[model samples]
Target: MDARPLLPSNEPDVASSPLAVRGLTVSYGEKPALFSVDATFPPAAMSAIVGPNGAGKSTLLKAALGIVPRLSGTVTVFGEPLARARSRIAYVPQRASVDWDFPARVMDVVLMGLYGELGFLGRVKAQHRARATDALDRVGMADFADRQIGQLSGGQQQRVFLARALVQDAALTLLDEPFAGVDAATERAIVAVLKTLKADEKAVVAVHHDLSTVPDTFDHVLLVNVRRMAEGPVATAFTAEALQATYGGRLAVAQLDRVAPR
Candidate 1:
């Protein structure tokens, strides 16, 4: 497993394996989401996992997080086997997957970030509350800490989710569609927050859809459509052919702007 920073920051990213997948295969009943997928996540970098809908983007992340069963392959995090490093990874699921009407307050949800270490029978302690508040402050959501999740805007809800992930204090973060329905300004704010994570030397990967923003925001990209089409540096793997392959041969990328950096 290579731990080096995948993207070159202002200074060259030194290597330290953050996450690695080798021959990873995942299936849901008879259908397969990933097939023999092999990849590595560079430390301290933001990686865009781009793919059309149902291309197994979420499945791959789930497999990595041990939420879904993987038919084969191995995942390792921070130089330790994934199962052994479970406590160091944070996952922010899609907002659409949750019920905002559940009636939980933002601060309460954020405190769940500490539940992994707190044991199932234990309730959130005072220290956990402090950490949740700190995370909300970092995301500029301190004022809305006491608001019910249902009352928040889409962007505000997303920020709360990010705060939850941050409160985990994990070394690696996986976000599924964090920018999907947010406003442009919200998108910018989220991207800025992700950049801050890189500065702090944490690896963050997002399941992204917008093609125009990939180059400007991501350093590495995993182009997927059902199976792995290409995985490499953004500039090389996000080429016209790669885009077409990942888009299921529907996009006329050959005539599209090829000058964009991957």
Candidate 2:
């Protein structure tokens, strides 16, 4: 994990950012993948970056993390630019994007979370190893620590990757389809952790495709489609017109569920 002190200096100008994104844009060679988009994620809310395929949900998240080269605009985590503050952040890539075929064990994969800060090619220290194990236990992957990643079930793999991110213990996390291809139980577990992150005052942005769970899983929403069409409190922004614009009216009756009033 990043042992760095909480850099309160950059904490999102909560009043200004939530997740202030401006002039944001992206492209794939000659083709434009995203347009001049702008958005903000309200603080202390579970936000879902949602849209149909090709809506640029993934691209938006990637741009926020600097994983993709943005053509223009700025992405600020808290108040700090993501490029200048990676250690303060954590990312969980899409499961399908990983090499499940690789020869690493569950523990090894989680340990990579430390490789970013660990000495070049040096062995992982005891504390880092312990952190990995603790992360596994947190995600309920403790028993599978020694097992090959490919030998585990789809749910197990997802937890393992999350454990890796958990080890980072970042104040902000961005997950790309973390619930994809997982079972109900796994989905529940991941959602529970997401709640924990929010309870801990961390900001989380999840790229979600299943509109069914959007209501229950998020308090805020960012509707995308090669451009940011709308973003705000879930109840207000997750409207039918926004969905139509983002999905090109191609989405079936949106199966979005509603959160029970507190």
lDDT of each: 0.81, 0.79
Off by over 4 Å in 2: 1-18, 253-262
lDDT of 2 at 179: 91
How many backbone clashes are present in model 2? 2
- Tens-place lDDT digits, model 1, residues 1-104: 12122222332222355777778899888988888876677788899888788889988888988888899998888767877888888989998998999989
Task: Quote model 2's TM-score.
Answer: 0.88
Task: Estimate the TM-score of every prediction.
Answer: 0.88, 0.88
Worst 10 residues of 1 by lDDT: 1-10
| Per-residue lDDT of model 2, residues 154-255, tens digit only | 899999999999998887788999999999999999999889989988888899988768877898888777777667677667776666666776655533
Alpha-carbon shift of residue 40 in model 1 (angstroms) = 0.8
